[model samples]
Target: MGQDETVSNTALEPAVPQAEASRRRLTIEVVIVLGLSLGQSAVYSILRIIERMTRNVPLSQQTSTLNQSATPDRPWLDLTYQLVNIIFPLFAVLLVLYLLQLTHPRPWRMIGFDLRRPGFDAWFGLVIAAAIGVPGLGLYLGARALGFNTQVQAAALADNWWTVPVLILAAAENAILEEVIMIGYLYTRLRQLSWRWPMIILGSALIRGSYHLYQGFGGFVGNLIMGAVFGLVYLRWKRVAPLVVAHTLLDVVSFVGYTLVAPHVSWL
Candidate 1:
């Protein structure tokens, strides 16, 4: 009987190690997702506070001489804040994954970040973009027809050729941050909870739209539609890179068009 019991224990030893490794990988993924999200939220809150405090100061002497002072270093400050906001969250995610050794070549390949395979899906992805893009274009026009605020305020910024690069970077950052959190992390976590596809997509869309609520009703509706479309695309493709590229294209068009064209449109 003792000999049989020892045999059983020996049989389970390999299984135990495999189970332990699986658990560790899962734990690392969970921690990295949660930590990066929480860190980004905290940083956004701090930025809001700083913005409110700075808004208290007058911009011109006519408003209030005592409060009026030029922020001579404003450009640098804005750039720094943008960099911190954009880069820190990505760094947090990468750092945690690195520490846990879960960022091996296999994991990245599994995540579909491996770009080596150029297949039919790449063409299909472009087709999907066009299908979605046409309707999105119509919707924006409809919004404008309904007397929405399509006027862009940052026009002068684009006068310089350098602004094009800056805008591209901003769009890329937006795509990465949003896609990583919403599709990559949140969808994976929700799946673990046995969530239905519709529920996951709707929840993601709502959350995505909610984040843009501060931009006003038009922005909210636009973002909500954008979120729904992106969510559908994600569901279909399961590859984030396509969605990121599509998103960047959409944003670049919107920003550049609004800045350059909307204000000059007679109907607007």
Candidate 2:
């Protein structure tokens, strides 16, 4: 019996070493991911400040300028605004990730950017958006009805032929950058810390909402609700693609309907 016990103990020794190695590897991966996320976040924050300074104009005035410059004859300026406002920030984030040696070469896998599975959940996400959006829209309208000054009084610039493409690109950039940072990186890391899904989702949502503070209370509330919904989707699916698609679609809907169809909507 003693010899048998000795053999059993010996057998367990190899398994212990393997488990330790596995743990070490996981620790290393977590450390690398955390380092990359922190670095990217810092860089993005600084760039955003610099971007705001360089613009040197309020968002309302900037929107007006962009609208005026978006004429058919001035396609270049319109394109430039699209690149500056939408494309460049995304590029900067990705570039920073690459420089930090954090991004995978496959790009899609690096950001968990899968589009193959637009399953029932994808449709469900849209439904969820509508569920939230409809109520939010009502609330926005109600706020306006109650004489709250939550309206964005921007003119329709969608008459420009170039506007659609620019807005589409903007939507794509937003989908990529926001998801990559908020869900892909942050969610993954938070999970490593053994955080429950609910906590992770809520924390991500709050951070997402807080970032929209400059957009006004309605924007903040809208984003908070959207973030929670998107975070829930991410928690369930663990795929960024469908969320990206859903987000892009929502933005497209807003741009086309709110800006083009009803520019003077009380709550945009």
Candidate 3:
């Protein structure tokens, strides 16, 4: 063969094996990251839902509480515990960023986790928060009325001077962790693997919904829808920051607003 033909054959020979290896590596990476983080949550959530289903009480009468106090009798120690709980889960996010940097030169910007477009992120986030939050509340209420959902106490932390700030911090943490890992990282990796958009969005939505199964069927379905919506938004804008903002706002209202309203109202 001529030199050009020899070089061409050499270059082409390993293409299939290289592509297969790349896909395998990305797949393993995704599985490992998820196993350590939300995938773990998803497993426990599945178990919790099964447990709730087996209980003697109706699902509607049962409750799933969030932001509970770790040490109710000791406020200062409880505060310490709360902060620790809120702060530690984010290590998973750091792990993701580190892994992404191995392949992408600017991983934060690639994932849209930076503050490059504050105004667009903020306004779009508010719009999404309202769109999801109002209907999500309605779905929860309706599901409860029909005895298909649990009474979710969005916030049950004791009234400490630090309660609101802790809740807000928790909200932000959840937003950043979920958006970056779920939409930003997973979507990017899956697209690299040549998966179609429909499958990517659906898979992400399923995982999102699965982790919320502890709350009941309503929570699962509602979050499934939310995940699909958020996934679509990420595809359209190519930005996870807006989704993070929207998630943070939605969670803040659910967490802090519940504490403020639960005491004064008969229905919550």
TM-score of each: 0.61, 0.63, 0.93
Candidate 2 backbone collisions, by pair: none
Rank order by TM-score, top first? 3, 2, 1
For candidate 3, write residues 1-268 as lDDT tens digits. Answer: 7765555556666456777898999999999999999989999999999999999999999999999999989999999999899889999999999989988999999988999999999999999999999999999999989988999999988888999999999999999989999998999888998999999999999999999999999999999999999999988889999999999999999999999999999777
Cα-based lDDT at residue 31, candidate 3? 96
- All models: lDDT? 0.55, 0.59, 0.93
TM-score of 2: 0.63
Clashing pairs in 1: none
Runs of candidate 3 with Cα error greater than 4 angstroms are 1-16
Candidate 3, clashing residue pairs?
none
Pitting candidate 1 against candidate 2, the one with the higher TM-score is: 2
Off by over 4 Å in 1: 1-86, 92-105, 118-126, 140-159, 266-268
lDDT of 1 by residue, 105-223 (tens): 44334434347544643565466567666676666456545544242232234244344555666666776677766766566656655679889788777667655433323444666
What lDDT does candidate 2 reach at residue 212?
47
Error of 2 at 164 (Å): 1.4
